[model samples]
Target: MDGSITGHRPRAAAPVGADGLAARRGEAVERAALPAARRPGTAGSESDTPAANALDGMPRQRTARAAAATPTALSAGTVANATAPVPSALSADPAAASGAPAPSAAPARARRPGSPAARAAQAVGRLLPTPFGTPFTFGYALVLTVTSYVAGHADPAVVRALHQASSTDVAHLVRYPVAVLFASALWIVGGILSPYAAGFLLVLTALERRIGGVRAAGVFLLGHVVATLATEVPVGLAVWAGHLPGSSLHRFDYGISFGVAASVGALAGLLSPWLRWPLLALFGSVLAEGLILLDDPMTNWGHLLALALGVATWPLVRRAARARAAAPTAAAA
Candidate 1:
C-alpha cells in the first residue's frame, strides 16, 4: 500500500483573526508593486484580439477582422480627435448667443417707455439709422445740410451759378459728366423741408437698416443716374433732331426725388405683401396725381420712371434683407 493519505485535511485552515488578515494584506502589497502594463486598464491586455492571441501561437491572420472592427487604441484615438464635435452652446434659443441677453439672467421687469430701446425706436427720421453703420447717409447728409444753409444765404447769382454747374442739363453733362452726376445728388433744391427731402431721410434710413448703407447708396445712385439720363437723353436727342428748341439743352434738372423714389421701391421689396402693395399704390397715386396739372410733364414722367426702377430691384434688396436676418443681431448697420 504505497498510499500516503491523499491530503491530510488540506493544511489546517487559517485563523479568522490574525494570520489571515496579514496574508491578505501582503497579497495586495505585491499586486500594487507590479508595473502599470500588468495592471487593469493598462496596455497589452490578453484580449481575444488576434495580436494578443498570436503570442499563444495562433495564426497572424486571425486578427485581421477584429483589428478592422475594433480600432486599436492609438488609431481609434486619432480618429476620435479628428472627428470630435466642436464645442457649442448646444441651445436652440437665440438668447444663448454672445450678443443676445440670456434668458432668466436678469430680473423680470416691464419695459419702460423711458428706456433707451424705446427712445431709439421713437427717434425721428434722418437720425433713424445709427451713424457708424450708415456712413454714406451720415457724411452725405452733413454735407447737404451745410450746403443748404450756405445756398439760402448766398447771393442769388451765386446760387444760380452753383445749381447751373451741378444741373444734369445736356450742356453740363456733356462738359462735366462726373461732376454734375455726383454734385446734383448733393442738394435739396427745395431746401431740407421739401417733401422730397423728407422722403429721402425716411426712405433711405429705413433702407440702410434693412440692406445696409452701401446697398442703399447703390439703389439711390442707380435711380438718380438712370432717371437723369432717361429724362435728359430724350431732350438732347430732340434738340439734335430739331424737334426741341436749343434752350432745352439748358433746362434745370436736379433733385433727390429720383433717389428717394428708388429707395422707396427697394424698401417695398423688404416689406410684407400686405404692406408692399399698399405702399406701391399710395406712392404711385401721389406720383400720378402730381401730373394732374401737367405743368411739368417731363419731370413727372421721370419720377414715375425712377420709381419703377426701384421696384425692379426687389430681388437684390430681398437678398440683403435675408442676409441681415441671418445674423444673431443685425443692429442698424
Candidate 2:
C-alpha cells in the first residue's frame, strides 16, 4: 500500500525563501493601497490619508482632519482646544492682538491748481458776498444806484443827450460799438423805482448763490451783449433795407432791463418744481404782454430775447451749482 501511494514529499513545504518573499510583497501592496482607500469619495473616506502610515513620517494632505478623526485617549476638553479656530484678523496680523491703530485714509485735495474748476472754487469762497451773497450783483447795483442818483439830479437836457449818445442804435454802434454798448447799461430808463431794479435784486441774488458770482456775472453780460446785438442788428438791417426810416437808427434805448430779464430766466431753472413753472409763467407773461402791445418794438423784442438767452444757460448753471455746492466743503476741509 505504501508503494502504491504517490510520495511527492508534500511539495517540499514551498521553499521558505520564496514563501517569505511573497508574504513581504503582499504587505507592501496593502500599505500602498491603504491611503488610496481612505481618500475622498470611497466607503473608507473618513480620513484623506492613512492614519497608520504616520510611522513613515510622510506628509499628509489634511493632517488636522486626519488627527481629529483618529481615536485618542485624551480628554474631550483637550480635543476641543486643539480644534478651536484662530481668528483670521489675528492670524494674519501678529500685532492685531496688541491693539495697534490702523492707518486712516488720506484727505481730499483742497483745490485743483490752475484749472477752471479751481478758479470757480476760489471765486465761491473768496468773492461770495455776505448778507447778500452776491458780490457781482451788489457791486453792479451799487454802481447803478450812484448813476441813477446822478441822472435824477443832472439837467434833463444833458441826461437826454447822454441817453441818445449811449443808445445801442445803428448810428451809435456804427460810430462806437464798445463805448455805447457798455455805457447803455449804466442808466435805468425809469429810475431806481423801475421794475428792473426789484427784479435785478431778487433774481441775481438767488442766481449768484447757485452758480458762483463769476458765472452769474457771465450770464448777465452774455445776455446783455447778445440781446443788444440781436435787437440793434435787426434795426441796422431795416435801415439799410429801407424797411423803416433812417431816423430809426437813433432810437433811445438805454437800460439794464435785458440783463435783468436774463437773470430772471436763469433763476427760474434753479427754483423747486412747484415754484419753477409758476415763476416762468409769471415772468414770461409779463414779457409776452409788452411784446403783444408792440410798444417800443426794439426794447420789447430785446427783453424776450434776453429771457430766451438765459433759458439756454440751464446746463451751464446746473454744473456751476454742483461745483459751488461742493466748494465750501472742500475749502472747509
- Badly placed stretches (over 4 Å) of model 2 are 1-132
At residue 300, candidate 1 shows an lDDT of 84
lDDT scores of the candidates, listed in order: 0.78, 0.78
Off by over 4 Å in 1: 1-127, 329-333
- Model 1, 227: alpha-carbon shift in Å? 0.5
Q: How do all models score by TM-score? A: 0.63, 0.60
In model 2, what are the clashing residue pairs, if there are any? none
lDDT of 2: 0.78
> Candidate 1 residues 1-333, lDDT tens each?
578776557465445677767775555444344444553223564444545644532222313344345433235456767754334476666554443555576787876568787667677533554578677776777888887887898998999988888899999989999889999887897887788876776778888988888899999999999998999999999999999999999988887888888888989988899999999999999999988879777888888999999999999899988897777465645
- Positional deviation of residue 154's Cα in model 2 after best superposition, in angstroms: 1.2
4-54 per-residue lDDT for model 2 (tens digits): 776565433444587777885555444443455654423466543445444
User: Cα RMSD to native, each candidate?
Assistant: 14.9, 15.1
